[model samples]
Target: MTALAGLLVLVSLAALLWQRQHTLLTYFQQEEYDNTRFFTAWQNVRLFDLRATATIVVALVVIAAGAPFVGVKLALAAALAGIMLIERRYRFKKPLAMTERAKRLLYLSFALTLVLALLTVVHPLWAIVALQLAPVTLVLANMALKPLQTRVNEGYTDQAKAKLARLDPVRIGITGSFGKTTVKHMLAEILEASGSVFYSPGSINTVLGHTRHIRQRLQWSHKYFIAEMGAYGIGSIKRLCDFIHPTYGIVTAIGDAHTERFGSIEAIAQAKSELAEEACLAGGTVVVNIDVMQYEPFQRLKKIYDLRMITVGAEGSDVVVDAQETDGASWRISLHSKLGLIPDVTYDLPLLGAHNVTNSALAVTLSLVIDPEIADQIPYFTKTIAQVPHRLQVLDTPGSALILDDAYNSNEQGFMSAVASMDKLAKKRGGRRILVTPGIAELGLEHDRVHARLGEFCSDRCDTVYVINPSRIPSFAETIDADKVTVVEVPSFAAARAAIAKDLKQKDVVLYENDLPDLLEEKRLL
Candidate 1:
């Protein structure tokens, strides 16, 4: 009986551990295998949440009281069942992908779980520790695989470097705290008028991610390779610049987008300047938004580097956006440049948001730098340029409520713009403006201050606000006018969706501002 019970506990625990592994790996992948972030997220699990704390306490009491009365095997079985219930409560918004790297980590994690489970068989008390080892096991596996991961990454990077040398595509690196991805897509579309353009598809900005795409997809016919670079720290963009060696660089804007990761806004600006420094070194023309030119690092780079600097923005820029007028579903934008690269012209942009006018100007400016002849084709190319999905994308639902999805990667300016867009659409459509968001992430010390401002802005524009993960942004609710706007706090997106679905009416405009990953959305021990 004891032997059978021990085997059952080990087998059942193995299954439970496997389930927990997926949650860990999903976050690990989302964090881009950053061990510090992964472990920090792990440590933040709400282990003492009412339900979890109660489950643990009951299991402990059941084991102590019922061990001698019900016999050790049955008591242990009951405790295991209780722990399994708690594990099952955890459900992630996104599932883990079983990639080659994930599989290696999964294997090592399972092996660690087995070793701990075997000890539980000797004394069931070990089960307590065994079941909670998922995060630790994942950390150990990642630490063990670091050397192999580094070597593999280096191999792919080298191959990509060699391939780029052979093909020699006009490399253009775009980096910003925000708007980089949008600009990459816009530039790729505009450059298509010139020749074949191959961009890092859909935020694949990392060195390895770029290397993988370059190895498999980037070819000889690609006239331009647009790399959208992202940075978590000061040297991150510099390392990517060393990898791609872009001839052209665009700093779209600098803001408090990832101040948590970079430590400060100054650090972020310094990191984004790496692309400009590298582009200047390569003797390539650099296009910068006037917003980014305010940064001291960019000012220093402009003074030191003798590279062509093309500035684009609303005003006082080389490429100046003269005006942006909403024309029903599309926007009519007028852009003129003092640099003479862009001819003064007004073109219809089939995109939403006021910031997109600046984004389009940035792309158009960079596109003209490569080939002056492409200017005549801008009006036609701008018409064909499709809106980047999930970045102020308007969803088509004939009879349903209108949804503006600016949910890809959220920044403060983008969020404000999205809200303003939603309000305008609601007024135009004669409907109530609804805002559903989890708020922005990685703001760190600025979290409350930013959210208060956002809440104040939203209170005026939004008729009703659905705040997902309300605890993360308490100031959002505090600032909101309860009488003017209905503030509904929901624990998860699903809950918010349920509430919205119940109250949704035709002509209502709902703006899904920022969809955070599973890490920010849910915190659980399992």
Candidate 2:
């Protein structure tokens, strides 16, 4: 019975480690590790349900009372076997592979659990309780490995910096609350006309991710390297700049995208402005959207840096988007800049959303800064740009229905822009406008207010709205006029898809705004 309990404890610890690998790493990576966040996340999953908690508690009590160990051993073994079975059933749905540091932490956790399980011969309760304390073990293990991880990361970053210096590419740093990726891709496409260009792929905006990209992908043949810098607080972007040493920078737009983490809009701006500050300090030009200039910090940045600042927007800017007309998934815009390089320029943008036009304007401004001759050929280069996936990407269904897949990263501005674009497309097709979303997140204190506003905006534009997690937005029902629009609450995306298949017609337009991962959902663990 003792040996069997030991085996079960080992298996249970393995299962728990596999399931919580991502969560553990996320907590470890936090600026200040949050135990509350860790516990809250663990409690939301079935593997750490109340039954598991109670089993460990009972096992601890049994050992403390010096009762016959057979009953507690069998109970723990059975409970652990059940959790392993449950975890195995859903193992195929696992998320991304754990990082190297996370794998190291898991190995440490396994070693510690084994040490505790050895005590099962004397007291089986020790092993059982250790299984339940896997999270605490993970925390301790992470704390021990942090210093070593930092050293390894610094070594890798140094290697990347050495590689970057040898390649000698003209780096352009891009940062914002949102639209950074879009601008990065757009600029890459436009700048390709000038020479070979490379960009950090996907949302790999972290320090390690950027280091990996520079070390692995950055080639000597690439003339322009675009780095999308992301930050949760001040000095984050500066760290990336120190390594890459970008010659130019662009601040797309500042908003409440990461206000939750930074705690205030000013703090968020300060963090984002680090990119511009570093670029200017290197004697490089910085492009900013005029829309964010109303903020005081940006004004201060302009005064302090006294850098070559190019502002792009519809009004009050050096590079102006004169007029924009959207036709389906494409845009035709007239752009005129005070810089004279791009004069009364008319271009076709193969993208969606009005915000995209501004993003392209920034790209255009940067391209002109790089090579002024490209201005005359802006129309030719614009055609080479394509719509980025999941950022208002238009797809066609089997029944000729239009599916607007904007389900990637969600923020207030991006969500509203997609809704407006969807409404326009639906009007043109004379189709029923359907919206499927779980609503936005990460607004922190403003989560409810932002979601409420999104709900109100959908009430007017959508013919039928399928809210995946209606409870996520507590103020949703109050903001919407149910009498005017049909609102369907779904428990999951599967149910929403079923409803769409049953009701959608050929001319229907379905806008999938934002889909949250199951980890963020609120539910009973069992």
What are the lDDT scores of the predictions, listed in order?
A: 0.82, 0.76
Q: Model 1: per-residue lDDT, tens digit, 1-526?
A: 7667666656666666676676677778877788888878776654222332344456557667755533554554555566666766766666677889999998998788778877865765565565566678888999999999889889989999999989999999999889989999999988998999998778888888899999999898999999989897879988998999999989889889888888889999999989998898889988988888778988888788733777777667778886556665677877787657656767778988888888888888888788878778888999988879889899969999998888885788899988998998899889999998999999978888999999999988999999998888899888998989998889888888899998888899999989998778766644
Clashing pairs in 2: none
In model 2, the worst 10-residue window by lDDT is 87-96
TM-scores for all candidates?
A: 0.94, 0.89
Which regions of candidate 2 fall more than 4 Å away from where they truly are? 1-40, 43-49, 54-79, 91-94, 122-124, 304-307, 339-344, 522-526
> What CA root-mean-square deviation does each model show from the true structure?
2.4, 3.4
